[model samples]
Target: MPRPRYLLALAGLLFAGLAAALASAPRDAGSQVFSPRAVVPMVARDEGAPPPPPATPTPFAPTATPTPRPPTATPTAAQPTPTPRPPTATPTPAPSGLRLQGVNWYVNTTGTIYVMGIVVNGLSTPVELVRINVRFYNASGQLLATDTTYADVSIIPAGGSSPFWTLLLNPPPGVASVEAVLGTYSVSSRPPITGLTPTVTNIYRSSSIALRVVGTVRNDSSATYQFTRVIAAYVDSAGYVIRIETDYLEPSTLAPGQQGTFEAIFFNAPAGLETNNLLIWTTASR
Candidate 1:
């Protein structure tokens, strides 16, 4: 039992190279070990086979599961903002009737300020567009001038009355007192814009026109009037209204019994104006 000597010459040189590779193999080369060119031996395999069975695993070609990659237009975090729409509102208008009755104020001699008025249709119907607002104060109160006037009667007949005036000329240096109210009015059931009918006798005075008026407008109803306004109010001796005028009737149309003629001149009359303390009105329209 003694073996050594290079392991007995390496087992006789691996038994003479496996008998010279079974005498140059082939005769069914041991069934080519499941041939296919003897399963690739590339000229000289120096003994390689087991590693080949692993290659048959290529049947696991299941790599097609990559289709789930579609939601990426650049966004990996932070996203949430969408909500805005709300704004559209406008509706306001509702207020009518309430104060302005016989207010008065006068000042003249160059500062000229008169806020005369009279609007009284104390309900029971009939009233029409009676705007008239005046302000102008300053006796330690502030606010100095603002005037708007209207209401020379276009329809006031329920107790009837209408006449308004407003004027302010260069006043605002502590102009002292004034505040006539009522602005914007309405309560009409029609009828009373009449067909014109006014008459203010004829009066005169002039030292450069300090009051003078003459009027006529007459188209007594049957409808056929037009424009024709002739307002006029010039009282004093304490009735306030020191000259309010609006004239125009040289032919402001009138035809159902025609008659028209108007001429007025009142250069701020005040101090004792008496042509019967005047007040005339006329308005037309069919």
Candidate 2:
């Protein structure tokens, strides 16, 4: 029991305190559990809303996109280089037994062309049956005609030379050059005739148409010769054979220690011939 003024003061103080407490209270009503029955209504409503669609999780988190890497260069296989080869050298031809000495080309009377030349047996061994070929050419180095001839002597002695003559029956017009070559040659290993002594004399040109060679050959070997043949070679100043001739002795056979006289005559001997030589040999028995 208070006086009226005291009561008014007390009421005023209470109201002020109530207003301050209301202002300081929490704004979220969920922070305070008024009763356990309040949770039941909230849970019932959440079940009706389909549990908020299982929290609707985001698919992925946002992040900076990875920078693209530059394209890698592909490796290439290496190729092998080929090595170059050097050029091969050419070989030279081998030398032969006979060699060319000289060549002469002349247009004879009656419009017949002639090729005359000489060949030598450069080897130490004797070469026989040497055939020669002459090629005629024009001024333009083209082949015009060809001719063939045999050596003057039957057999060319070692280090000896022989002459060859080719008569072109119908030479091409304007023949200007000539080339003579030793076409072929044969070498004989046969045993040479021995023990025949030959004496040569009276070497002279007869009537300007024949060459006369007078000789005496004696069979000094043990074997008797059935046939004796005398061979003569007309030689030039250079010791090359110009012409060759053959002669046979009378009675054909000669006993050992028997002698015979032979007269060899050469027709159409060339003018440049200066000397003569004789060779006596017997043929082998059949």
Position 226, candidate 1: lDDT: 74
Name the top TM-score candidate: 2
TM-score of candidate 1 against the unseen true structure: 0.31
Instruction: Give a tens-digit lDDT track for model 1, residues 1-286.
Output: 5579889899999999999999988663211111011111112111111111113344557756766777668788988886876867777742233334435555556656556666656556687777765666565656667777777778887766778776778776666566665655666778776657788777777764366788787887777777877887755444444456788897888878888889787775543455436777777666
lDDT of 2 by residue, 193-248 (tens): 45567777667777665668787778888877666766665443443334445677
**Candidate 1 — what's its lDDT?**
0.63
- Would you estimate the TM-scores of all the predictions? 0.31, 0.43
Q: What are the lDDT figures for the candidates, one per model?
A: 0.63, 0.58
Clashing pairs in 2: none
